[model samples]
Each structure stands twice: as C-alpha cells, then as structure tokens.
Target: MTNRLEQTKALAGEARLAVLTWLAEPDRHFAHQETGKPSEIGVCVTLLTEKLSMAQPTVSRHLELLRRAGFVSVRKIGRWSFFRRNEDAIKDYKEWMNEHL
Candidate 1:
C-alpha cells in the first residue's frame, strides 16, 4: 500500500502531469500530420516536442515516464512512435487517489 502511494506520488510531478493533461485533449494540443495523421493513433513525438517547446529527447523521456505510470499508451507505426492518453488508467488512478488519499 505504501509502495503504491509512492508510485502514485512519483507520477504527480509537474512535467508528467502536464503530459497527461495535454494528452487528455490531443487534438487541441497537437497538430495533424500529412502522412501519419494525429487522429490515427495519437500525437507523434515531433508534434509533442513542438507543442511542449522542448527537445525531442527530453519529450521522449517525459513520455516514457508517463508510459511507466500507465497514463499514456504508445503505438509504433513503422519507425515512428505515437502516443495517446490511457483514459481508463487515468480514471482508475483518479478514483484510487480519491479513495486512498
């Protein structure tokens, strides 16, 4: 139980939380691409980097953290990776936080 609480608190960091929030409304935060299209799976790393105004590697690290927390889902298309919010997981986390803390 304490371990779970620690894990939850780890994900509450500002950058990770911001990533989750942006993913909640993907279309609004990300622009559509000509080839892959943001709607197909989620937003591409390029768009996310642009939106966050951060470098690709930095955004990739942030996405990885969000993925570990189960707040984001990734789909690999060819060589490119796309990311979207895991709504169910986010909802479950919110409920658990409400109940536990």
Candidate 2:
C-alpha cells in the first residue's frame, strides 16, 4: 500500500504529464525529416524546448524526472539527445493501475 502510493506520487507531476501529452503527438513534437518527416524518429530536446516554450534546463529537469519514472527513454547520437515515449512502461503502468486500483 505504501509502495503503491509512492509510485502514484512519483508519476503525478504536472511537468511529466505535459511531456507525455507532447510526445503523444509525434508529428507535432518532432522535427521535419528529409524523407519520413516526423515519423523519422525520436524528439530532440531542442524541439521539446520549443514546443513546451520552456528553458533548456527546465525541460531537461522534467525529462530527467520522466526518465526516472520509466515513462521515457533518452538516446544520444553525436552531440544530440533524443527522447521517446516508453510504451512498454506505459502499458505496465496501465496494467498495474487496473490490477491494484
């Protein structure tokens, strides 16, 4: 019971919800690609910054929170960082919620 409450608190942040909503719209959240466009891949931090209209550090902090919560995954290539929704984690969360609450 205590552990379940802790899990709820951890995922209940406003910024984390906002980030999830943003990621829900991949085409709107990601940049245009030469070929596949938004479907090409994950969202860049800079793009997330612009979409959220928040400072880089603020976005970074929220992203870190989400990463810790297992709601998102971060990948780095060269100097750029990309973030994508962790669908499996989300599915697990839903299952837990259904089973427990």
Candidate 3:
C-alpha cells in the first residue's frame, strides 16, 4: 500500500470520486452487468469506462490508484476485473479525518 498522503491524493480527483460514488451504490447508478451483479462480484471496468465517458486506460488508472490506496478491492472472474468499495478502509479514513482534521 502507498502512504496515507498518496492514498488521500488518489481520492482527490472528480472523476475518481465519481467512480467511488457510482461504486458505492452501483445497482442504483449502473445497470446489471452480464458477468455478475454490481453488489456481488463487482462492477466491471468496461461498464465504468462507458459510464464515465473516459478512455479505458484513464479509468483503469484511477481504479488502480484506488486499489493501491486500499479504498477499493478487485476480483478476477475469468478475463474481467471487477471493483468494489472497501468500506472498512473508508471508515478508517473517516475516523482519521474526524480525529485529526
């Protein structure tokens, strides 16, 4: 994992934040993916790319940053990668904010 400063930086972008928001309640924001449910296996990067209207590499880079930051987790199902929020890590960040800032 990267340092907390780097992790916080990963969460600072509008697009990345949007990604996190969409992932937080994916079923509400995104349609059911053919591979799996949004709440279960996770949301596909391809779906996120379409929704965000960005190139796949850009979206993937954001997801990779979040993964390194421990703000999200990934699962592999065949050739596709799925992503979901890491609620515990998010909670920890919130707690750190409340206590420090």
Candidate 4:
C-alpha cells in the first residue's frame, strides 16, 4: 500500500536504521539500571551516547530521525530523556514485510 511505501521510505534513511539497529540490541546499547518497574525503564540519552561513542547532539539528531520514522519512542523523566522501542510499529512493519516482500 502507499502508506507502507511511505513508512518504508522514512525508515530507509541511514540515521533511522542506525538507531533501530542499536535498539535491536538493548543490552549492548543501554545500561541495565533499575527503575523500580520495566515500564519506567528505558535507555538514557547519556548511556546511549556512551555506547555509541558519539556526541550528545549527534546522538540526539539520530534519535530524532528514528522518532520521525516511528521506530522509537522517547520519554522525559526529570532532566533525563529515555528512549524505548516502539514494538507495535516494529511488529506492524514485520507484518507488512511478510505481505509485501
């Protein structure tokens, strides 16, 4: 469908894929810090920067691209920003691939 094509086009960008690839391996890209509950847990921007060995602004730019592509979600807790995978979007993308690819 045209909608799927548009989404695919957005996701095909380089920065978007890098963010998704990082998210695909949470343990590697993020630190396992307890937040009392899993729902409140996500990869902190600082942790992500350290893992990627990149500047904060650069990481933020990449995150912005992924967010725009519907591949990730972000939440702010206090002064820190946390990012998590948008599983539903990913699942839908997989289903679309199965049907179209």
Which candidate number maximizes lDDT? Answer: 3
Q: Pick by TM-score: which candidate is best?
A: 3
The segments of candidate 2 whose C-alpha lies over 4 angstroms from its true place after superposition are 1-7, 31-40
Candidate 1 vs 2: which has more TM-score: 1
Question: In model 1, how large is the Cα lDDT of residue 70?
Answer: 72
- Residue 1's C-alpha lDDT in candidate 2? 25
lDDT of 4 by residue, 1-101 (tens): 33566567768666657667777766665546454232446677777787677899988987876676677899888888878889888898888799977
Where in model 1 is the C-alpha error above 4 Å?
Answer: 1-10
lDDT of 1 by residue, 1-101 (tens): 22455447648677777777777777676656654556557888777788778888998988887777777789988888889888887787778789977
Name the candidate, 3 or 4, with the larger TM-score value. Answer: 3
What does the lDDT read for residue 79 in candidate 1? 86
Question: Per-residue CA lDDT of candidate 2, range 59-99, in tens?
Answer: 89888877877778887867877787888877878799999
Clashing pairs in 2: none
Query: In candidate 4, which residue pairs get closer than 3 Å at backbone N, Cα or C atoms, i.e. clash?
Result: none
Q: Write the per-residue lDDT of candidate 3 for residues 1-101, one digit (tens) a residue.
A: 53789778998999999989998998887666887688988899999999999999999999999998899999998899999999999898888878987
Cα RMSDs, all models: 2.6, 3.4, 1.3, 3.3
Please give the distance, in angstroms, between residue 74's alpha carbon in candidate 2 and its true position after superposition. 0.8
Poorest stretch of ten by lDDT in candidate 2: 31-40
- By lDDT, rank the candidates, best first: 3, 1, 2, 4
**Candidate with the larger TM-score of 2 and 3:** 3
Residue 46 lDDT (model 4): 79
